[model samples]
Target: MSQGRMASGNDSSVTEFIVLGLTQQPELQLPLFFVFLGIYVVTVVGNIGLLILIGLNSHLHTPMYYFLFNLFFIDDCYSSVITPKMLMSFAKQIISYAEHMAQLYFFSFFVIDECCILTSMAYDRYVAICMPLLYKVTMSKQDCLILLVGAYEMGFVGAMAHTICMLKLIFCDGNIINYYMCDISPLLQLSCTSTYSNELVVFIVVGINVVVPSLTIAISYTLILSDILCIRSTVSRSKAFSTCSSHIIVVSLFFGSSAFMYLKPSPAGSLDQDKVFTVFYTIIGRMMNPFIYSLRNKDVQIALRL
Candidate 1:
């Protein structure tokens, strides 16, 4: 029933947070930092290089790549949100309530953006393969722009809603976040106030974010597969199936990690493994996407050659 620190009369003492990242062990810090630094380096290069490739090649400006262009942007920004903080981690960060909220907000924004963008991309592929002749008509430049805009909008709305709900809860127990980032689950675990409502909202929204998009993706690929199976030529079927399998792998890599992160119960005992999965989702996921989706791709190969 109590308000957040802002409205609570007794919360004047709690001004900032001490964020505890991955590990507290002295020996592990340097090694993990360096290792994540390498992962982040690859993330930066891969996403930026893919972006440039998509931009420069006029032939690559089709609807699929168009969706990918946005996806790449989201991937880069998404990793940037969490990885650098992990890399530059100190013993404990002096994070204000506002800063804490901002970090969680932006993190949620980009994470949800990735979800929506992936769904949009799946829809793009569905239209491209299942309804080839209607692909251009269905996914025009305007429609593509609308989809991109909607993805951003969905992210913004979800972030704002979560942040607002978060601000309503009081956090007097401790200002230390056990996880690397100010994620909702870890933060909720730290709340002193009754978190029934907060947990409910988290469950509902996260269910929608993970489940609905996952189902959409499943249905899209199912239709695409059914359409692919109807093709008669062996070479054509093999090629289409290969591309489809690659897409499935890329999608699985992301969704699997994401579901593990957001869909699980709150941080309990040793969260070391959770932190590792968090790293995979926030740091490694983006780095892998470009390679999974396009590293060996013929179009990207051609573009790079040019």
Candidate 2:
């Protein structure tokens, strides 16, 4: 809640920024810290466990699990990028400009990668379920590799765009970020210079990241659903739905929370709402993925038993 004197762009820039953690209530800090610490522990364990499980099990090396391997990898890295620093913010951490920028860049990179990877997973599922005969040919090792590389390339481009735009902004005023971590919206809110350009970039970049993947998933699932319905046997239909249901749940949770957080105009005094939405994708979403896929997936269950 601290305020700084409004200074001109020519004035001294903020050397560091204070992160006002999830809540200012003294009594809640320790409890919240423990809670998120537990979540982080589970996130690391669940994701890494899945990664190792997939790597060791030769039976799970199809294109679907190939995407799953990368998805878990991204989730692990994504959670690490945000959660540990967020835990420190409970102590009201002060981060240097360089540190904050690094956090921003990496966070942006992993998040965009997650979006693209999820879209690729949906495409993989579509091929596996809707066109079973052509799955291998269409999603060959080389093709899957191309898709994975493309996702990372998009992440790199999006992160660079955001970081470069942030570099142009002057933070000559207050440095307290009213949220838990260094995110695009909260950081933009702290800028002392005109953020019109930054906001435009956020909208364009976030729109493409959110919309394109969403549309891809939507179309893929639509075709998938159509194929599932054509199966005359109830058992076959059920199996097809089962194959896709996990991906659908994951996509819904991730895209729903992320789009809500980024695509809208961040109104003044909305940081609290922003924090809630951010927790869904950043913390809870990552924590839930491994359990969702493992518990729902028969192949993973079989691999675990073996």
Candidate 3:
């Protein structure tokens, strides 16, 4: 709420930032805390359970499930990075610049990793459904590992880019962050210096992260749908659709919420609304992924039972 003074030059006057949290109302604090606590609990339990199940079951060790394993891991970590600090925010926590930068780095890393992994999962589905004969050959252990490694590598590079750009900005005395965590948008709004370079980097990096993976997913599903349409058997068609339905649901939710948050122009007044959108991908979506995949996936259900 404070329109603090802008940075004079390259030097930063502010050493730390105050987090205003999701809401300033005294009444909503306890209720929101309990709600997010419940979300964090479910997110941890579900993702961890899925990770353990995949690790223990040999049948679930294929390319698809391998990707799912990493997905769950990232979701667990992603939720961890934001939710706990979010909980602390209800009590009004202050974070130093170094701490905020660390949060930004990890947050960016896991999100980009999720995008890449989801893209990989789409390709895995494409191969399995469109070229069943070569699924094994195409999605071998080495290939899966390469995809996983690439996702991590891309994540590191993207996170580094965002963090480094942020480091260049100078902050004046208006050190209050309106959101629950140290997100790039809110942090950019706090800078005393001109944020043109930072904003541009955000646009370019986010554009690539969102657009590239989205295109990959679209092409994969297009090919997949074409193959499915050619099949004559009703049961076969339904089976193929079922295999992809869960992924489709997840991709829609994750990409939709994330793109809304990062890709849009962050007018100074939109920070309040940003928190609402942030809740979807940061907490709710992560919590729902395991359920969405497990309920729709027979293998996961079977493994859970066993």
Candidate 4:
């Protein structure tokens, strides 16, 4: 493979990506596989159930729920990306390298998409809490659709940017990646060529996706806190806090694990540790999405009862 340049000078047709499994321990593989399989099952059911519940219950059709529907969709795609192959690897060792790249492409798409949608959700909450009178006006149905479209666009663009750079990276030597999937960092680490530009782009793109959304969530919650403090009644403050707490938890889990994974100056965080964190963000984090954000809400509870 040419160093940082694709054959025929076109970056799009690069054919394969190597995947490193979760562990090489023969004794541990089957047990770990079963654990992840169970987690994947829970993730699918939880996200699907949340989607159906919100769609069927008319009372849940507000902007909050609308954003949530997108969130569930993202989680569904996220879990689907790596879990099936992971399960298969336990049963059999050799996997298709091209298929692995395809999965990485799709998985990267949803990860970027989810970030944009979550940022929009944070902005929506800000408007609803800070400008309650204009809530419906600001987040109208058309606005929701536009945000959703923008999320998809941003996701594809970001993924394309990363994928293009990845195409330029040479993987001729030591095709074995240290991590379970085709994450940009692990992929870049395997490159025998100069990855300075690739590393910069990865940082910039991942930073934009992770930091922008995290900052939006932070600012929104800050304003929400101010608004809650201004309320005269303890009951109202408690209700407001309760409503916001769940979102805070979900945002923390998603962004926190992501930040931990990418923001480190060193990769001393052991591959095993990275695998654990990836599982948290990719699988366990998703299971917690519905539970932390929408499932426990009193409004959703009441809507479910009705």
Candidate 5:
């Protein structure tokens, strides 16, 4: 959490990092690898299946489903960044520091894109429920395209900034990442030079990542809730609530695990706990996302049926 132990120069003796996988027990390694392999397989299948379903279904071309498609795509990418290497960590290969930074770069990019996409989804819901008459004008095809582009644009910028900052840090020989992946926290713990500026940048970017979208979602849903409360018929209100329920679950899991993972200080003893929460947002969330949306969405279910 501090600036970290200071080193002499920007040059790093370490060309690569030895990734210590989840457990020390030899008995557990095989089991964990198989478990995560299963998860990664499911993640791939579910996301791809959902993508094909969306592409085939004419009725699924609305703003929310459009965003759901992006969500699934991001989830697929998000899990891909971490899981395959994680499963391979059982065999153990030395990966270059550059590869680690690349991993972090993509991770940051998709996570920010996801947050912004969810924010867009929240806005879509707000329009559908609170500004029904204006919804068409507010969320037209062009508007949806713009929002999606903006999300990726911001993700690119944030990822670039973080990756540049990380590249500046120096690591001595024998750098071993304590956890499964090259997340900001664990990676920062390895820097031989002062990481004050890098940590500050991470703090700022991750703060924006978590806080801004959360506020957008909360505000959107608040207005949505207020409108739903005003509805005269219970059936209408229930139907309205059904549309956003899956998004709510996805938001809660995404932001909750992410906030827990990044917002708090990483104590020395709790790296294992960190690894567990890491699995939640990174690996497990992707595997669950398609199922969550498909099951909760009547349109997607119907599309699958047809």
Candidate 6:
């Protein structure tokens, strides 16, 4: 296996990276930049506005919106971590190599954090729909706080694991990352050194992060469905189902795209297309969550109106 080392075989040397901006076509640059810039602006304002509105609205102080306010915060974090760097890539195509990895580590951290938060949100829906009377006791303020802490901790620990593993890699071969931001898979491909440990960590961490929550979400909703079917009143059933549907939409989009990009095997064993998939998972998915989960939500709409 090729080992990443300096020209003098010194292990303590820093490497720089060159980012290939979104599109090489000069004609496409400005238009694409403005388009992404607009998306970033909307993402920031919508998420922040939702968080503030939820916080100020006493009516939304309950467990579910508490989960949502946290969700909005995650959206804000997710966008802030990825989009600004993307915008800067437009201004200057190449990024600082070491700095890019550091940024990527943080971005991955938030992405993992969002996964946990979404799962927590799903659990909130499960409780709301299946056990209404017990909802207060089941998802109490303390419970919500603990879950938020767990979400942040999960993100922090997972990110630390991935970043530490990435830093151990040898990247002397080439430093060109095809994606706009530093992602695990893209960074893995750059290693001139063996990636056995890196790949294993990716497998284990991503598997647990993606699969465990996915299964929990499925089970929670399944139990929820069983409960909903027992309700004889059509109007009540319709109302109950509507609220749960938004989360299903958001979860499906976020998790589905993520699974596709990360799990699929390529014949060429390449990640070029994966970079395109990253945009949907990071940028477009972040934007979609607020729209599907909040903007279109009757509760949020009502909250905003008041």
lDDT, candidate 2, 1-306, per-residue tens: 234334444565666888998999999999999999999999999999999999999989888999999999999998998999999988757878888999899999999999999999999988898888998899999999999999999999999999999988888667888888888888777777799888888888889999899999999999999888899999989988988999999999999998888888653448898899998899999999999999999999999998
Ranking by TM-score: 2, 3, 5, 6, 1, 4
Order by lDDT, highest first: 3, 2, 5, 6, 1, 4
Q: What's the residue-level lDDT of 25 in candidate 4?
A: 80
Q: Assess candidate 6 and give its TM-score to the true structure.
A: 0.93
In model 4, which runs have C-alpha deviations exceeding 4 angstroms? 1-18, 266-269
Tally clashes: model 4. Answer: 0
Reference-based TM-score of each model: 0.92, 0.96, 0.95, 0.90, 0.94, 0.93
Candidate 5 residue lDDT tens string, 1-306: 112223455543566788887887799999898899999999999999999999888888899889989999999999899999888788975677778889999999999999999999999999999999999999999999999999999899899989999888777634777788888887777777788888788778888878889988999999999999999999998999999899999999999998877777543337888988988889989899999998888888888888
Per-residue accuracy of model 4 over 1-306 as CA lDDT, tens digit each: 632224544332234544558888889988998898898898899899889988998888998889889999899988888788777766654544556556667877898898888888888878977898999999999999999999999889888887877777666555556667767767766666788777677678889999888888898889989998999999988987887787778888888888888777754457778888887898788877877765669987786677
Which runs of model 1 end up more than 4 angstroms from their true locations? Answer: 1-13, 265-270
Which 10-residue span in candidate 1 carries the lowest summed lDDT? 1-10
Highest-TM-score candidate: 2
C-alpha RMSD by candidate, in order: 3.0, 2.4, 2.6, 3.6, 3.7, 2.8
Candidate 1 lDDT over 122-226, as tens digits, reads 898888778879988999999999988988898888888889998887777767777788778777777777777777777777787778999999999989889
lDDT of 4: 0.79
Give the poorly placed runs of model 3, Cα more than 4 Å off: 1-12, 266-269
Worst 10 residues of 2 by lDDT: 1-10
Clashes of 2: 0
How far out, in Å, is residue 204 in model 1? 2.4
Off by over 4 Å in 6: 1-14, 265-270
**Residue 205 deviation, candidate 1, in Å?**
1.9
